[model samples]
Target chain A: MNIELRLFARYREATGVDHERICSAAETISELREVLLARGDHWLVLADERLCCARNQTLCSLDSALCDGDEVALFPPMTGG
Target chain B: MATYITNEAIAAGQRLDALAPSHAAGAVVSFTGYVRDHNLGEAVSTLYLEHYPGMTERALAALEIDAYARWPLLAVDIIHRVGELTLGDVIVFVAVASAHRQAAFEAASYLMDQLKTHIPLWKRECHTASTTPVWLIPH
Candidate 1:
């Protein structure tokens, strides 16, 4: 399946890209993150427990299942007041 | 209920006046968050805010709905500014109106607490003496 990966804050700065389209066979959000982590050191930030995930723009857990064209966002915990 | 996410400056007085007037409303409470000059023991030069557009709006709307559900509120208004902001700039403004002071105060505090943890907004602080900016983790 293909995923629309959206990165923000530290994730965007580390990756040097805001969004990207990627093809992966990962079944869940966590699995997709694991796949990304395999890329290199820069992807290691995804391993942080503080990282937040959203499936299709709605907040979801890492265990959430993904579809063919899911929009997945990875960001740090919100700091807005 | 009203929410706004913009890059423009927030006019605190105008936003307070914009709240819908109600015959039952006897009290109004408001909170304004500003960009301070220092954080984490460092002198800050500027603060950059980022957010998920669609998700941010949805989150804010849901907050207003939750506030209304928890209190007998006559009106609620929230405005959050994005982009680069300098010291002393208003970053956010929230106002709640109710029939009593206690309800208005509690609801306003609830909205701010929920917003700090639940919203999809992020802040990056640029230090005065450092070339790199740091992303602040929320408590």
Candidate 2:
């Protein structure tokens, strides 16, 4: 399955890219993070337990399942007013 | 009820007036958040805000709906500004109207708190005087 990964804030800065299209066999967000983390230290931002995840723009747990073509966003906690 | 996330400056007075009570409502409360000149001892020159387009609106509308379910609110309006902002710029505005002051005040507070950490917006501050900029997350 292929999923669109979106990065925001410091996560984007660290990754040096705002978005990416990844073809993966991972089924859940946690598994997806592990696959990305295998790349290198630049992907270490995903290691932060405080980091937040959203599946298709709605907040979801890391265990949330993913489908092909789903949009997944990863970022630090929100700081809006 | 109306919720907006825009890159343009917000007109607080006009928004407040639009939410003005028509009949039984007796109180209207509002809260505005501003960008400070400094953060954690660093002199900030500018703050840039970003959000997830479709998700941001959905989160905000969910917040508004939550507020209505928790209080006796007659009306509600939330306006949040994104893009580049300088010191003293208004970053957000929240208003709530109800038949009494308590409900209005409480609902306004609830909306602001939820918007702070629940919304998808992110803020990054640049300090021209310093060598590096800072990216801040919700506390």
Candidate 3:
């Protein structure tokens, strides 16, 4: 499945890019996160325990199922009011 | 209920006035958050706010819905600013209208507290002396 991955704030700055369209065989949000984490050290920001995930613009848990062409966003905990 | 995410300045008074008039809307409450000059014991010069465009609106709208679900709310409006912001600039505005003051006040407080850590927005504080901007972590 192909997933549209989005990074914001510190995550984006750590990776030096805001988005990526990656092909993955993962079936869940956590699986896809592992795929990215295996890439290299720069992706280490995603390993943060405080990281948040969203599927198709709505906040979801890592156990959430993934689908083809799904939009997945990963970012740190929100600091805005 | 309405949610807006824009870099433009938010007019709190105008937003309050735009709420639909209702005989039951006997009370209105609002909370406006501003960019402060200091954070983490540093003198901050500016604040840089960023958010996921479409996702941000959806998140805020969801908050508005939740506020209504939890309270007897007549209307809700959430306005948040993005991009570069200087000290004293308004960063967020949350308004709630209800049939009574208790509901209006409680709903407004609930919305603000939930918004602090529930949305996609992030804030980076630029210090007066440091070249690097520090990303803020909500407490």
Candidate 4:
């Protein structure tokens, strides 16, 4: 299975792209982060922790099961007032 | 509280519209935050606002829930704008209606405090004079 991943803010700068994909069927946000970091060492700093994930616009947990067409976004904490 | 969420975000949040009678509550309180042209000793050209799509909405909903729990509120409307924003734009708006002035005032205060500390959003300061904009993260 493949999942669409989105990066925001500093994460986007380090990786040089806004989105990515992982060829896996895991049901955890942690797994997705690993793939991002594995693609390049740039994302390694955030690999240890679960960056924020949105499974189809809804907040997802490490255990949040995803399907084939779900949209997953990874971003730093929000800062708007 | 009434404006639609357009992709375009005002550097500051939107102003609360003239709310008509939604309820018979006697009080209405509002607070609007803006970007000050200067922060500390630096001149701020503009400030950018960003927020977690999921976490931001969740945090905001949670704040609303808390406000209802502690006060006898009749109505509440909280709307926050995202994306790149400039100075003097409305960043947040909190309005409350209650039977009396006390509840409306208290709930309004509580809502602002919660949004500042609880919401998963950050503000970036763009000092045109600086090399790069500073990302303001929560502590």
Residue A17 shift from truth in candidate 3, angstroms: 1.9
Using DockQ as the yardstick, the better of models 3 and 4 is: 3
Q: Is candidate 1 or candidate 2 better by TM-score?
A: 1
Question: lDDT tens string, model 4, B20-86?
Answer: 2456778888777767788767888887666655656766776777888999877777777666667
Per-prediction DockQ, in order? Answer: 0.87, 0.86, 0.89, 0.36
TM-score of each: 0.96, 0.95, 0.95, 0.74
Query: Model 1, which residues run further than 4 Å from truth?
Result: none
lDDT of each: 0.91, 0.90, 0.90, 0.68
**Model 3 lDDT at residue A62:** 92
User: Which DockQ value does candidate 2 get?
Assistant: 0.86
Q: Give per-residue CA lDDT, model 4, range A1-81, as digits (tens).
A: 678777776666667777777667566667666666676678765663536666776655656777876677776655555
Q: Which candidate is the best by DockQ?
A: 3
Across residues A25-55, which tens digit of lDDT does each residue of candidate 3 receive? Answer: 9999999999989989999889999889999
Candidate 4: stretches off by over 4 Å = A48-50, B1-17, B20-23, B38-42, B51-71, B113-122
Clashing pairs in 1: none
Residue B107 accuracy (lDDT) in model 2: 92
Report how far residue B45 has shifted in candidate 4, in Å.
1.6
lDDT of 3 by residue, B17-85 (tens): 877458779998989999888877899999999999999888888888788899988999899999999
Query: Best to worst by DockQ, what's the order?
Result: 3, 1, 2, 4
Model 2 bad stretches (over 4 Å)? none
The complex in candidate 1 yields a DockQ of 0.87
Please give the lDDT score at residue A64 for candidate 3. 94
